[model samples]
Target chain A: MTATAVRAPARRAEKPSSSPRRRISKRNFFARLSLALPAAVVVVPLLAIIVVQGIDLVTHAENLTRPGSADKFIGWGNFTRAFSDPDLLGSIRVTLTYVVAGVGLEMIIGVGIALLLNGRIPGKGVIRAVILIPMVLTPVVAGLMWRLLLDPTSGFVNYLLGVVGLGNDHAFLSDPATALPAIIMVEIWQNTPFVVIIVLAGLESLDPSPFEAAELDGARGFGLLKNVTLPMLGPVLAVVLLLRIIDAVKTFALVNTMTQGGPGTSTLTISNYVYRTGFQTFDIGYSTTLGLIVSVALLILIFPTAGRLMGLRIRRSRG
Target chain B: MKRRPAAVAVRSIVVYIFVLWCIAPIIWLVSTSLKSDVDAFSPTPVWFFIPQFENYVNAWVDGGMGQSMLISTAVGCASAILGITAGLPLAYLTTQIWPPESTGSSRATLAILLLTIVPPVLSLTPFYRALFGVGLTGNAFGLTIIHTFYAILLAVLIFRSFLVNFPREIREAALIDGLGEWRALLSTILPNVWGAMAATFVLALIQSWNEFLYALVLTNGDSQTVPVTIAGFLSFFGTNWARLTAAGVIGALPIVIFAIVVRKHMARGLSFGGVK
Candidate 1:
């Protein structure tokens, strides 16, 4: 029921007797526009800065450390360099791996857990409350805590491994092969709860009538879920999947805190690469160019699809 | 088809194990924080030890977490309030004043979504340069503005989801009865949307409090937030496991409690209202 209600409200025709209402609405445009002005004031300037400075910075090969470098305009220099930059290519590959593997596992495991929780479980409330911890734990703390746990020496994971005769001193974060996978594991551990919470809510709010009808028709178990439940859940699942992808693409803190995109840049995501360029390297021109390319590519990739999935009718010409 | 008793038992066990996976690290973190520095880093696990309360005291005082906590709270509250102040009216305009299905409403909402989709990395340098030019960097002022900017984006989306289906005739009636649009929102709509507002405030507050990237870039020294402060402990107290864990616990404790208190509203807010 809520699934449909979330769509645009039905359009109703105006009655002639509501002339006063019409007058108010006509004047209400500017009044209503005024209501949104404050948000515009805060947002527009930042957006303007992004565009104005982005163009200015992208055209110049200005290194912050070099004096009088701001006027050294090199048109398309940064963009051209970025295309051949091996680190940028490698970072993109790493980011894709993170988003795909991390989000994929999260969705599957999260949906499974949510489905399990929806069934008859003991202390359901307490179970739910406990699971929320990982989701809300400060990312930096989560990263550091996981780092401590996964530490090669004096770490509980190694201790457990020793007990199982798997060898105690496994350097998870320091090893290049294991480093990205380890970060992705931490990513799954932290964010899977997000998927569970949202998907569980979606499950709980699902209309009961379809299930009743499916049961009456002798549908049961996986068949029932595969047919009745999942079809009805398509929209919610799409939204959840979209959100997870968007967030996972912006993964920085966990990677930064856990490995600092190290273990030979095995886990260097786009954000980490940008931070490295802009702050660590002090290459302002290249950093802004990278930011613009990634931003534009991301929007081109997801913005229209996100709008449609959210049921917003976006026109090409409008805001 | 009802599940067999054995299947039911297995299912329950699977759920328990999942919960265990989720909670074990947190338990380890807390337990390690209570151990002595040597015990925390013992090559072998220390199953028994006297608890150390001084670690908390040390993390709180010596680590500058206390000061950072104040900075975080002030920034979080200021950003959340500013976000809601700007966001609610914009949500109202898109969902209530304009027909939600109309071109204008869709356009407005799409603009908000576009802003939401644009990664912060794109704007980070520009914002840093702009704010630094005005001497707003290295303090709470610039960071608060950026956080408020994001909070507004969050607030607008969440509020729009809640208010889109709210009946508009009530507001129209109030307008006809001589309540101005602002007055109508305050009297007629605001009362109904306290839940959304609370959800917005809590979520926005959490976002700002937990935010690290911008905080790291924009602020330093006394203005650092919880994440920055706790992260700084890593370099400052490299081998002091107990102190570091204590700092971690201190930093994560409040937000964990707040989230549990408001978990019911979190699904909607976190999903940007997709679930609701």
Candidate 2:
């Protein structure tokens, strides 16, 4: 059942003739277009506001506390200022590290656990239900819970450490050195289940014929997984990796609740920095500018690959 | 192939260990919630304590979590329903009317994907300003609109994935039998796509409920959602760990339970149908 669902898109690709004969008149075409109207009504205005307000804000010096500062137009000033802004650069670095480290670990740990779970295990249903908990837990609660766990004096982690004669008080979130790492650890803990769940589904849907054939030829265990299983699971892995990266880059709640991007800016992700500038400091103009820059950079960095992986058509320039 | 007892033991142990890791924090949260403030903050683990319900009461009533729960549910359901109402037709238009692989379908899907991946920060301030200008900020209405926008994006993608290969002939056949498009959709397609709609609603509801950033920025006081209210507990209670964990439990319990109940659909929806 799951295999059919997983293969539906691939099946659709092979059966273009299935949809070719659906006749439509001009009125029907308009009616079909009108089907998109409600979504468009909500999305279009918001996109317009982002573009218009973005353009207007990026050119000005509009701090909310300063009266009439919205009128101060200095074209590209915020963008130029961002180039030298140490905090912005630092945030960019922190975000990259967070995405790379957090997502990288999640993929590894998640895939390993999924592989384990895919094999026969007792009480599999109960284990699967338990795995769903962390993925669905509220991020704010996850962060706060981790904060309590990592607390210097009273945290469970510290107590655990003390039990093993590792010394109890490490001040994980308060020390700049350990703050980002602690948050990333929580990121992995909370989201690795996402990877396990999806990859387990993919594993379940695999065509077993290859495994049978390989096993008959002496391929087993690690060899079977390395040769047959991983290759078959390539597309699923790519999609999961892509999705994890997309989600991890927007890591705000974990850092916000845990450190508030503090301990001298160690855990300050791009989202937290932008939120601080826009909401806390009320630097509306520069905040918008920072947002536009980060967004454009992110699009350029991720979406081209995303579009391709998700099978969206894009014109390739011919040599 | 022979069954290896040692390897089976190792695998079971490892899997169980991972499960323990996943749920241990939640266990701590619940246990701490039932402890008194001093016991909750004990330098050592409180392995034994009489469970108390006062913190839960405090969080539910005084911390305003009861109010937040109502707001979150309303917003989540409203947005999910609105999203499906808008998104199902567009998904049908793109996948059923147009070929699933056509430029029309790809473009619509791509647009939704773009909206999905674009960081919400790009629109946060602009939305705040726009909604603030129209007197929608600090209330549930603006956040509902924002959540609904995201839900619509989510719904379109999930529904498209499900309906893309759901042979268009069913709808076409219904239409040919003197039924209008709306009636055909109502009588034929909607019935078939209830699974997709359910998945979309569940995931969208989860998304809206757990969303923190916009809820933090857009709403305050009475209109705050669960995350906003629970996070507020941090400062409001100021290291009253018992009350804090209690509020967190109150806020996170419903969706966590809902998610577990629908875990089968979650893998597909969370991946946007990348997996099944």
Candidate 3:
């Protein structure tokens, strides 16, 4: 590296008449062949797996072959089955409640972090990194870690509450009443970083000129934030909200890990419901049809947002 | 100056509180993992104690976390490599095989993006039945195949950014030189876009490493990875804290290391097109 750096300047010094041989190595066909084959070998199979899976999924179309398995045309058989099945329905309800509440909470918390962290603070980079702890951990780990720390008896949350002279330690996750709240608490702890990062990116993109103008126009701190900063951050906020909503809809590992759809189907989300119905019960065909229905239903909402963002993204990659 | 000092302190203090809230749970997890079984379940709770290393060892050795970790590492790393390589060329094809700035690119990109948003669970039935029909389930290759499907979507999204700005004239001229498309892609294209490829690889690593739902669903017990083992630990032990914490910590280590390395790529992957 040192030799190369030293030679770089020397090479530049003589570059007014550098040799053409060095630049013409692009014609090395065998060399290109070696590299191209490896690249192709590496990439092709990975995609083939997914393409294959997709083909398998669409081609099987269980409802078509196996009548009375799920439903006709796969509209809502899986969904209706899920809705009627107490466990699956419970999971769906839990998932809906959590997605709405959890995402709503995340938006507030995330936007707040974005506002708080934007453009100033002590050791902002370190703060940002530390703040990302929850987001970065594997979801299962996050779930299990919380389980250990929040267990009614020996968990540190109990210990902390003891120190602060709070409520009974065992009351947490001990009853059906508090189990879902406990699950939500764990999720909020685990996923809030997603909101922070998304909203932070939005806040980072805003211009300070508006703030300056607002200040000159006698806009104070809260006033500046309300009228100027919030509006500037709108597009990113929308994107963040949209992304988090879909992600929350896919909430499975956390609920599965912490509660196992448990204490009587309280924490079971729709995805977990599908897992239980299909895999656990061995009702593979029915589960497939049901899961498909849920997918199609969610697809209606997820498609437009996912498409718009991807469109914006493709434009970026191009320009 | 007086107001500024107060404002800065207020900002610092408030932000610190949130950060504390963010980290407090993780700090708690680590601390809880160190407590002995007696101390762990004690209703009174013990904050400070002689730290325990036995749990880590117990988790690694007796807990079978080591084996699960190996499986996860094998699957995660392999799938990431495969996913990125596949995604990059597809992105290249999408970019170059069609004219840039045309409706064709839009359609191609949209087609790929559609694949990304398709909920995994929705296709579970078909995929599971298909896999069973072909005897792919419980096999490592089959698991990799399942992982590659989603990871490829991620790869395409990541790889497309690099491929889009790729100079088309360079490709055109390479073609004019009697070089084949694959040859041009390898020699002329990859070297310039190595950084983006690295980013995609890192993103794939984090994603595949953290992936759980598919692994849990697809793999047989023998091939099941860390997350599945850890999540299902409850069903076996009926809520054994000692074993579960050990398993969770063991499961968390690689992902934590990967997260620190690829934190920036995460910014790209998650933001997707938001950040240029």
For residues A1-319, what per-residue lDDT tens digits would candidate 1 score against the true structure?
3334335443532231266566566666567678989899999888898888888889998788998898999999899999999998899899999999999999999998888777777788998899999988889999999999998999999999999999999999999999999999999999998888888988888878899899999998899989988887777788889989988998889998999999888989999998889889889889989988998999999998998877721111011
Screening candidate 3 with a backbone cut-off below 3 angstroms (N, C-alpha, C), the clashing residue pairs are: A43-B85, A43-B86, A78-A290, A91-A268, A154-B40
Q: For model 3, how does the per-residue alpha-carbon lDDT over B1-276 read when each residue is reduced to its tens digit?
A: 014767778878888998998888777667767878777667775768998889888777776778778888888788888777667667776665444344545565676666666667776765665666688788666677777766777777766656666667798688668777777888788888676766677767667767777788778666878888887777776656766776777787666766666666566557664653
Encode model 1's per-residue lDDT on B1-276: one tens digit a residue: 357778778878998999999999999999999999989999899999999999999999999999999999999999999999999988888777776666667788888888888877898888878888899999999999999999999999898888877888998889879887788888988999888888899889988988888999999999999999988888888868899999999988988999899888888878776776
Error of 3 at A258 (Å): 1.4
Q: What fraction of the true interface contacts does model 3 reproduce?
A: 0.47
The TM-score values for the models, in the order shown, are: 0.95, 0.95, 0.83
Candidate structures ordered by lDDT, highest first? 2, 1, 3
Q: lDDT by residue for model 3 over A1-319, one digit each (tens)?
A: 2223212222332331244533544553344344334445634554464456544433332433455643324444444555577665566679888888888887787777777777568888888788777886888888878777777766677777777888546655557887888888777777778878767776665566777777888888788789888876665666677777777888888878777787877777878877876678766656665566677778786887776665554544433
lDDT of 2 at A136: 84
> Candidate 2 chain B: worst 10 consecutive residues by lDDT?
B97-106
Q: Which pairs, if any, clash in model 1?
A: none
After the best TM-score superposition of candidate 2, give how far the Cα of residue A109 lies from its true spot, in angstroms: 0.7
Model 2 ranges with Cα > 4 A deviation: A1-24, A312-319
**Per-residue lDDT for B18-116 in model 2, tens only?**
999999999999999999999999999989999999999999999999999999999999999999998998888887866666666777788888887
Clashes of each: 0, 0, 5
Retained true contacts (fraction), each candidate: 0.64, 0.65, 0.47
Residue A104 accuracy (lDDT) in model 2: 96
Q: What's the true lDDT of residue B88 in model 2?
A: 91
